[model samples]
Target: MKKVIISLFALVAGTGFAVAEDAGCEAFKWPVTREQALFAAAPATPSGGTLAVGAAADLALVPVDKAAFAVPPEHAPGEGTFGAVASVAVPPEGAIQISLSGEAWIDVIQDGKAVKSAGYSGVKTCPGIRKSVRFKLAAGPATIQFSGAKKAELKVAVLTPE
Candidate 1:
């Protein structure tokens, strides 16, 4: 009986530790500088639309439509699974800055391939916080996709290093 009790306690402790560690934001590397440019503020309509952006137009404001994506039961208010695509043109190889209205999982796709992504266990309880990710991107066309935001409508912005 003593051995069984000890083993059970150890298993439970280990599980708790694992969950804690997995809850962190490890998939996306946060940007060093919070610099970004504000572009357009629009709604991420049901039939998603693509916006043409240049290095000059780094930041964009688009409200997320919660009804567009699947929301899990445990999802917090202002949090839902949503996706928006943006077409960007980079003059030269440089860094891309992406900021979302709330906690979000981001994916950067270029040439039909995913170049970057972010993963988190649960919704980030950031009501007005703008979570951002910066990545090195090649010069050309790239698509930025955002999902798992903590709000029904979110502001999506993009920036390229000057």
Candidate 2:
């Protein structure tokens, strides 16, 4: 009984598994404390097939086939991987950051073209996030796509940096 309990404790503490909340975010090139906190919180489930999300809305996600993309993803998913896309309204701030709970390809498509990333950072040791991508966006709507995900369902967050 003690051995079993110790094993469980070891897994919870750290192992060759996913990260724990507040673990490795500070290592990121830019500060990701806000994103880390939101990711630690229970994610909001999207209603319908559409994805109109706001700050701290760490989403459970919507999986879709590659054929659904009006514009192809910048990086394609490897064999056996999955993908997800969300139409997000970029706030007037003109720049926003999208945080991911898993490793995947991220693309922000607006007006049928990909918006270039303004900043990029991620750490494998971060418990709830695998990476975060920032884009310089116009104040309006954009399509955020995630490809090459090993899992069909993933958690995501889109936030306007302060």
Compare the candidates by lDDT and give the number of the best one: 2
* lDDT for predicted candidate 2 compared with the true structure: 0.71
lDDT tens per residue, model 2, 1-162: 999999999987775344433457766777777766766664465422344445555444344464366578887667777776678887787788888788888888988899889988878877777888889988887887777788756667777765
Candidate 2 residue runs with Cα over 4 Å from true position: 1-23, 44-54, 57-67
Q: Name the Cα RMSD for model 2.
A: 8.4
Query: Alpha carbon lDDT of residue 59, candidate 2?
Result: 46
Model 1 ranges with Cα > 4 A deviation = 1-47, 51-80, 117-127
Candidate 2's displacement at residue 124, Å, is 0.8
lDDT of each residue in 1-162, candidate 1, tens digit only: 999999999999999878766744432344312322242433343324454433222233234553232222222325334444456664475566666556656666666666653322222432333466666767887666655554445555565533
Quote each prediction's TM-score: 0.48, 0.74
Q: Quote the lDDT for 149 in model 1.
A: 50
Q: What Cα-based lDDT does every candidate model obtain?
A: 0.50, 0.71
